[model samples]
Every structure is written in C-alpha cells, then in structure tokens.
Target: MFEKQQVIYLAGGCFWGVEAFISRLKGVNSTEVGYANGNDLAPTYEKVCSGKTGHAETVKATYNPKIIALDEILESFFKIIDPHTRNRQGPDIGTQYRTGIYWQEASQRDTVIKFLRKKQKESSERIVVEAHEISNFYPAEEYHQKYLEKNPQGYCHVDLNLIDDEEFDHLTKEEYEITQLSLTETPFSGKYDDFFEDGVYVDVVNGEVLFSSDDKFDSRCGWPAFSKPISEDAITKHRDFSHGTTRIEVRSAKANSHLGHLFHDGPGGSPRYCINSATLRFIPKQEFDKLQKDKY
Candidate 1:
C-alpha cells in the first residue's frame, strides 16, 4: 500500500498563474488558491493586492508520491520562478507576490534546508524564498480555482511546455541523463564546483557508478578529478591515440558527454580520471540513504 495523499503549499508570483501551472501536473489530486501568512479571516483579492495585509497569494497542492516525489515537486518549483529575485515574479512587484514554501510537517524542514543550501551554492546568490510553518490558510473565492481554465488567454507567464510531469518521477530524465549519459557540457559553469567535496563521481548518462572519494584529489583543474573509478565495469574506456600520444577516453555506457580523459600518471597507485564539473550531480552520504529508500 502507498500513501496517496500529501499536501504542499507554494507561493510564486500571482495565484492565477501558479494555480494554472500546478493544476496541469500529473500527480496533482487537487489545487486551491488562497491567502497565507496573513491575519485576515477571509482575504479578498482586492485586500491582498493592497499589500497592507501581508498575505501572499498561495496555492495548496495535493499530490501522490507513488506518482511524484517531494523533491521532484521542489525541482519543478525552482524552474518556474527565480529564487534570486526578492518579493516579486516578472512584472508583479509586491510582497504578496513573494515566493515561499509552507511546510505541513516538521520532518520536511530538513529536506527543505538541504534543497535550499544546494540551490544557494549553485546560484551563489542570496535566496529570498521563505520556508515557514503554516499558520492559517484562507481559501480564495470559487473563481480562483482554475483561473486559466476559465480564461484561456489570460495574462500568465507560466509556459506549460517547460513543466514536464515525467521529471517528477523518482529517477527523473535529468538524473537518468547524469547516470547514463557522458554529459561533459557545462549547462551552467562555475555553479557546481563545490559538489566534489566527497563521494563517488558516477557517469551522468548511465547508472554505471564510478569514482570514489578516496580516489579523489585536488588537482585544481576547475573540475572534479578522481584517481580512478570504482571499477573498470563502471566506465567504458576507449583508446584515443589522437594528436600525438595514446590516451584513454572515458565515456558512459548509456550516453555521450565527453567526460575528461584518463591518464596513467597519478599520485599513489591509481589511474587519474579528470572529469568535467557539469557532468556530475553530488549525493552526500546522508542523502544517499534517503534516495535508496525512495527507490524501493
């Protein structure tokens, strides 16, 4: 048996756009637009828009983990809104339009903290997004439920094409690409240089696990470098006698990313794996346990 009902509150820009965007998600059982972090009994749209109430336009979403995970939901949330911006999304400029995550339970706080920390490090910016406990939820009027559905050509910035439900799956396409593909292209450089602190650097394209913390050494090569992968089976090594000397080209069994070349010349008694920073996603030991449990 699986837990079918889980609730999460999101406040991003206008409630109309947020409601419209979240309603289309696959696992979403229901969505209700409301006012949160305010003292009013039943805040009207006009009252909230006044900016004096301190109420943010929020959406309460009910989803199922068998179909979607909280992490996936959070990831999707990140893509839609700019966390770097303060108290605004696009042209809507006000505190009522602020971004926030209202945690329903105490257990979720740690996960939120971890996600926020990783996000802050990746962006290297001050995160203005708020994470707080739910005090009270005042549901908006009936017209606010599916504003976009009611008015197709309404003023909304949410592009539905970017929101893919498949990404919410436990092993997402991004994760699959990392595990199976040899993705060497840096989508955003200087963003994930700190991800090499510890643990193994596996092939981002295939699930072939490679490289370990013990084998990792600071080469100051701008990207992560490992003495050697965990095993030869973890990577498909190819002989490249290009230019002048013969060298080993490291590739993932699942896809191509041109992860840096390997060399026999390395410290200790191990091969050197010079890999690109963008090709890997770090999984700390603490989070690894949660990932394994979620998979089963």
Candidate 2:
C-alpha cells in the first residue's frame, strides 16, 4: 500500500506564485490557493488585501512523502520567498504577503524548527517567517486558483526558472563557493566544526552519503574532522595546488563537489578528513533509519 499523502500550508507572498511553483514539484499531488490563518471566518481576496482579515495568501500543497520530504519542500519554499523581510515579498508590500509555514501535523513541528535553525545560521539577517499550526483556511475564488496557468503573463514574485536549474541551484552562496569554486571556509567558522551529533554527512549538492559520526574525531583543526568516509568509493581525492601548497583535496564521488582536504596527521596514524560543513548535510541516525525504511 502507498503511504498516506502529506499536506503543508505555505504562505510565501502571493499564493499564485506559490501554487505555480509548488504544484510543479515531482512529489506534489496538487496545490490550491487560499487565505489561511485568518481571524475572519469569511475571507475574500479583497478583504485579505485590505489588511483586516489577518490572512496571508497561502498555498495548500499535498505531496507524496515517499518522493519528497518536508524539509525539501521547506527548502524550496525558502528559495522563492524572502524570509528575512516582514510582510513583504518582491513588489508586494502588505500583511497578506508575509511568509509562513502553517502545518497540520504536530510531528512536522520539529522538522520545521530544525530546518529554520539551519536557515537562521546561514542567514545574516533575522528570519521573520512564522511557523505555527494553521487555525483556518479558506479556498480562494475559482478565478484565483491556478492563476499563473490561466494567465501566463501574470505578475509573479517568484522566479519559476530556478526550478529547472539543478546544478548549484539548491546551494547557498557560501556552499556554492566551497563546493563549485573550490574555496575553503574560514577555520572555526563552520557550523559542524564543533558539532558531534550522531548522524551521517551527505554531499550538499546531492544526497550522497560521504561520512559517518563513527569515523568523526576531534582534530581541533577548526573543521569537521573525520577519520574516514563511510565508504572508499563515496569520495575522490585530488592533489590541490592552491595557495602554494600541496594538499590532497576531498570531493564527493557522485557530484564531484569539493569537500575539504585529507591529512595524514591524525590520532593513531589514521588519515584525518577535514571537511567543510557548508558542503555537507547531516541526517540524524533516527531520521536516516526512517528515510531508509520509507524507501521500501
């Protein structure tokens, strides 16, 4: 039997763009434009625009979790909306334009919080996006539903072209520099430099398992230090000649993304793999097991 469908309410500026972009995702079953989390029981687009309805233009997205996780959806949502800005996105400036994640399930709260925390660390500005249980949701007028599909030239705040740009599209600015441009992050500045959570680190560009916590050790080198990767085939080593020094650089085998470097100086003669946190995504042991179980 197929897994039950999952739903997530997303309010990212105008609902038209949110619906347009979210509906096109691979696992998305459907999307509906709506006014959500409003005090007024009877909500109309006109009332929402007037800033009295307390409703944000939201998109109700239903997707198959087996194909796409909630974190992926949240990550995609961030790409289209400005989380740092309050009550505004692109040209729209109103209370209804505020971005939010209104979830239905309590289980999703932890995931949302974790994702937001990671996003907060990556951003220089305070994130203003709200995460809460949805109070009320009302379907928008029939005319407003799938507005972009009906009117191709409709004004949309989101850049729909980003969906097609797979390479370096999902990566952040620092991640792109570290992975694609082969730039090393500053010492002691990465998120995972001091973090020793029980999890597996995967390539940021692609979800390819690279290292595990079992192989991780405190090298005090101001980077995430690992004794070895999960598998020898998971990574490729290259001779780096940058900065007038010879160093063995580590890169993900699948995406060929620049990870960090390999050093022979480690405890007990084991090679130390100093990796950039920006170039990796850590999945906790429980979550990893759940993901593996969900696959089959």
Candidate 3:
C-alpha cells in the first residue's frame, strides 16, 4: 500500500486549542504551532498577538491520508471554529486568532475549495474563513508547542468533548438524524439487518470497536442483531422509556451515540442488540486486514 502524507496549515482562533484537538486524530503524525500567512519572516508570539505581523496563530499538521482523509480533517476544523465570523475564534478576537486554511500543495486547493463551497451551502451566513496558499509560516516559540498538553488547565475555546467524529465526518442527513438524534431506522430496511459478514463492527461515531462477526446473528429483526458486544465496557446500557415503551438503550461509551434498543428475544435467549445500521459501520475481515488496529 502506498502511504501518503500531506501537510496543511490551519488557524482557528488559539493555536493551543487547535493543536491539542488535531493531535488526537487517528492519522496525524505530528503537529507544530506557528504563525502563517504573515508578512514577517519569523514572527514571534508577541508580535502575532499584537495583530501587527499580519499573521494568525496556526498549527501545521502532517497527516497520513491513508488513515484519515483531508476532508475529514477540514470538517473537524470547521466544527471548532466559527467560519462566519472573521478575524476571530472562541474568546480570542484578533487577526492573530482569525480562521484560515492554508494549503501547501496545488492538488489540495480543489478539495479545500470544494469543501468550502459545500460548507457555504450548509451555512446561511457568509463564510469569512480565508482559503489561500501558504506564502510563509514560522514556527512559534518552543513553549507554544503543545501548550495545552503542558498545561492542562490552560485557556482554550475548543471543547474537546464537542468535537465531531472524524470517522463519520461525511455522514448523510439520515445517518446524522438517526445516530445523533436517537431516531430509529425503518424496520428490516437497514443494509446490515441480514448481513452476516465475518468481521468486526465499530461505532460509527468514534470508531470504537463494538461488536464482532462471531456475535452477530440474523434475528429476523429490522436492524443488525448482535448477541453480544466485543467487551462489556464497549457499550453503556440505560433504561430507555422513549416511544411509549420501556426498553434498554445502548450507547457507545466513547461517542455517546445511540446504537439501538436492546431486547431479550435474541438467539439462545441472549439480549439482542437491535442496532441501527446507520449507527454501526461494519468492516469485513477481508477488508480489515490492513486496518486491524482500532482508530479510537
């Protein structure tokens, strides 16, 4: 397999928060805080913070596209920054904290522009995020690198909890409504309702390993039926009384995504997890050989 690595510079308010958030992704090899799109050759934090250097505090990330695509990375950045607001992000309001996407490669421009166009349609307000080629970038001071990692209580606008799942970044409207809003898919109409592929099933939201093909069985149910989870801690069970009925609801611990209601009418009298196909991503054994390690 050909491994591809790409570098992209993004500034979303404070570099500390952006750096911390992006470093947690699956394919990110390294991240460095810097000042980008600036006039100064080697801008420092003091100069950039003054808003006179024409630079924005940014993070340069080297990522493996084979593991996570550029689109996913861009979408994750969007989720944290307010694209409509110009020259600011979170609590930091200045040119230094402005949101921008600086590409190092010409081939990446098309994808970046297309993503912005799609984001524009989804947004009602005009986008203020700057999309341009990187003219100059100067790495920030040594202390600025991984600032959040050094100081856990440091100030940051990006809430680590509110970030969207990179794995399901391009989820369809139906999938989002079902997974995020706890809506149920149509009975027996799901793609994996009767699928019995030999592989592992993971949480669509956070990429956490959830179920295995060995535990999956056809239960004549509308959703994918799993007799058991890969581990007891993989899922959290709660008493769900929604939809005018009482049932056990299962959600992924890492993502808090609603899988489906649990019933005891499964094979061998085991609890059948009638999981929604929209909330679960199945990776068959043949295709999973290369990505056996869990992303989460």
Candidate 4:
C-alpha cells in the first residue's frame, strides 16, 4: 500500500533554522526552505530580503499522519517559536522573519487555527503568529537547502532538544518536557483544574503518591490546586526565581520532576499548592486501594 502524507508550511523567523529544526521530527518525510504567503510569484532570497516582496521565510514540512498527529506537530511548532513577538523571531528582523502557519487542506487549516486559539489562552502576551490560507510558496535556492545540516554551526533560536523522545516512565514527550524541562502548560488548561474525582494525583515520572483528593481545591489557578501535599515528605522545595520573582519550586520527591509552585494565598488556613497537570497522573478513588500495594 502507498503511504499517506500531509504537508504544512511554517514560517518562524529564519527559514534555515526553522527547516533544520523540524527536519528532526519522527514522522517528517522531508523539509524544504522557501518563501511563503507573499504576493510575488517569483520571490528570491535577495528580493524577499529587500523586504518588498511581501514574503516570509517559510519551511515546508511534509510528514506522514499515520506516525504523527497534526495537533502534536502544531504543539511542537509552538514550543520553539515565540508567538507573541510580531514580525520577528530571534535576531532576524523584517517581514521575511515573521512567524506564521499557512495551510492548504481544509482539515489541516482547521487544525492549525484551533491550535493557535488554544495556545493564545495560555499566555498573557498577545499572540502575533499569523494563521492564513496558503497564498504562494517559492522554494529557496539550493545553497539554502538543509543549510544548518551543511553548516553544522548555523544559527538557530530553537532548542531542538526539547522534542527529543526521552522516556520518563509513563510520560509522553510533551509531558516529559513540561515536567523535566520546567515547561509550563497553559493556565486553566490542565485536566484536573476543575476536576474533583475522589482519588489522588501521582507523579507521572514515578508512582510516588503526591496529592490526595481531599486536599485538592478550586483556586481558579487553571491547574490542580491543592491545599497541601499528602505529606511534607512527598515533595521537595527549591528556591525558584525564574520569570523574575522569588517562589518555592515544587517537585516530586521520588521523580525529582517539577510539579509547580507554592503560593501563600488560599481560601482557608492552607497555602495554595498550584501544580502543573502534565506532571501528575490521576488515580480514581475506587481503584486507589485495589492496586497492588507494591505497584502504586
């Protein structure tokens, strides 16, 4: 049987770096550097660089859907590019350097647009990445093809290591990155934020029980809020001043994976334990005791 393939175009800063970054994905069949969403049918590197061709440096990613989902690809794209910055990514500047996702197929078009809207809710900064129907795309010159692979030391604002498939027990790539890499999920985006099932949440990286259902509360933090950990020994705290503030960073004791942060404000006498949903896996109360004592 012939293999099925899907194509999508992404323009995030420099095409050279963007092309190289995506070329490493698992399902990717091929990637080509190009200029897209411009009026000029014959846009060249020089003409686009002149900032008058109305072109954006773009990367055409062709991949097999049977291996990778469209939503996962879109999430991977969002992880590398800063959606809030307008008309620029990294040090590159001008219209050619702007970040965007252009689509052709109706299914891909809806997927891209839906992903963007979901991503926009996660950040306070305004999303500047454009989502548009495919207008035009001109393949870049041969020398620009796989420029980073040839140069090896070429410039890339993206951290390609973020997507590497590293097993974290039962965690997915996105879950692993969010837990081990300190990457935060969108606020109010976690499954347990408003969930009140009568069970507990355990560290995804390890089966160490962390938070009990009784302690879970609604803080409107968009994450699973707990009044406290199941016990003081269940978690560890470290000094975290990232994003320009001082706070206690929470991590699972057994897994040493980032859970979230501790805040002083809470409804009653307890401090609010704001946690990331990706870092914790939930166990329903009914099955909590049914599991083998050694497994949970």
Clashes counted in candidate 3 amount to: 1
Compared with the true structure, model 4 gives a TM-score of: 0.56
What's the CA error at residue 124 for candidate 2, in Å?
1.5
Error of 1 at 253 (Å): 33
lDDT of each: 0.69, 0.85, 0.81, 0.80
Error of 3 at 255 (Å): 17
**Candidate 1 regions off by >4 Å?**
1-3, 165-296
lDDT of 1 by residue, 124-207 (tens): 689989998876788887777667766878888666667654533444444433322222435335234445455555544444
Please give the RMSD of candidate 2 to the true structure. 18.8
All models, RMSD in angstroms: 19.5, 18.8, 15.7, 18.3
**TM-scores, all models, native as reference:** 0.55, 0.56, 0.56, 0.56
Could you tell me which 10 consecutive residues in candidate 2 have the lowest summed lDDT?
236-245
lDDT of 3 by residue, 1-296 (tens): 11246899998999999988887665554578889988988787888888899998889987767567889999888888899998878777888988999999999999999999999999899999999998788888888887876688998899877654665667786676566546688998888888887999988776788999999888886788888889987876766543446777776767667788778997668789889998888888877766755533
Whole-model alpha-carbon lDDT for candidate 1: 0.69
Clashing residue pairs found in predicted model 4: 188-222
For model 2, which pairs clash? Answer: none
- Per-residue lDDT for 1-296 in model 2, tens only? 12266789999998888888887665555577899988999998899999998999999987667667999999888889989999999999999999999899999899998999999999899999999998789888888987886787998888987676466678898897677556678999999999989989999988999999989998999999999999998986765544547888777766767799899899978799999989999999999989999998
The candidates, ranked best first by lDDT, are 2, 3, 4, 1
Tell me the lDDT of model 4 at 82: 82
